[model samples]
Target: MKVSDLDVPELLDVITKAISPVIFKGIDQDSSPHLWRERMKLHAEIVGRITAVLHCGDEVGPDIGEIIEICTRNMRAGYEQSFSEVLGPGGSLSKIRKP
Candidate 1:
């Protein structure tokens, strides 16, 4: 499904359910509203990027397999930074030249 078609709360719920006790430990009860909002925004952004990459279907676009690798192997920058790193620059996406 397109990222625009996604539901934030539902997406969060699915992720939370899928990961179990390994939850996004990035947020907590004491987290400030502003901090939590920023984190949530980042979560949405990364999800959108991943959805975009998977749907692009262009050879030059980022690979879904590689993106999964990053998600599983790297937790240093959370999700957004790591996905963006895999995507390289926005220019790289622009270089796709739709087929």
Candidate 2:
């Protein structure tokens, strides 16, 4: 069955779960606008693609990891740009937290 066969709310819930980590931050949103903007952009991209995949139903057989990888790739580029803006010339990666 096509994803469109599902109700709107169900479709949204599936999409939300797929993109949960990106959209579900708490106080971070209140404190960090720049980071939040990049995150939201990634969230939107992931959700949009996931939604399309779902809408395509069995034809494409999309995987969540594929969606995440795409989001991460785009997000990384956005983050690099955001870091450049915030850190300034030769600001160094010291400000970024080490994982």
Candidate 3:
């Protein structure tokens, strides 16, 4: 079934479980907001594919959390490294005057 067919609670549970690890990895580890945004975008893409796979297959073997965990664990194996540099670590954009 499509995400539209899911109840609100089911959708929330699926989305939350899919993205929770990314939040923890980004927030608690001091990862940049840019990286977090990319992670969220990747999550939406992967989850959509996985959900479609489930819909097409007759398998009901895994819970949503388990499936998400498997997908993320595998995806991370091929993730490329990228860095985000903050121009002013703690300063507002308006406060950073060009020299």
lDDT for each candidate structure:
0.48, 0.58, 0.51
Q: Candidate 3, which ten residues in sequence have the lowest lDDT sum? A: 79-88
Candidate No. with top TM-score: 2
| Error of model 2, residue 48, in angstroms | 0.9
lDDT of 3 by residue, 27-47 (tens): 533445556546655765575
If ranked by lDDT, best first, what sequence of candidates would result?
A: 2, 3, 1
lDDT digits (tens) for residues 1-99 of candidate 2: 655566755876776676666464662413454565555566656665665565555566546567656655665566567656645544443255455
lDDT of 1 by residue, 1-99 (tens): 555466655765576455533334665545454454455455555554544444434443447666654543343255446445434455232234444
Question: Under the 3 Å rule for N, CA and C atoms, how many clashes does model 1 have?
Answer: 0
Clashing pairs in 1: none
State which candidate has the highest lDDT: 2
TM-score of every model? 0.36, 0.43, 0.36
Predicted structure 2: lDDT: 0.58
- Between candidates 1 and 2, which one is better according to lDDT? 2
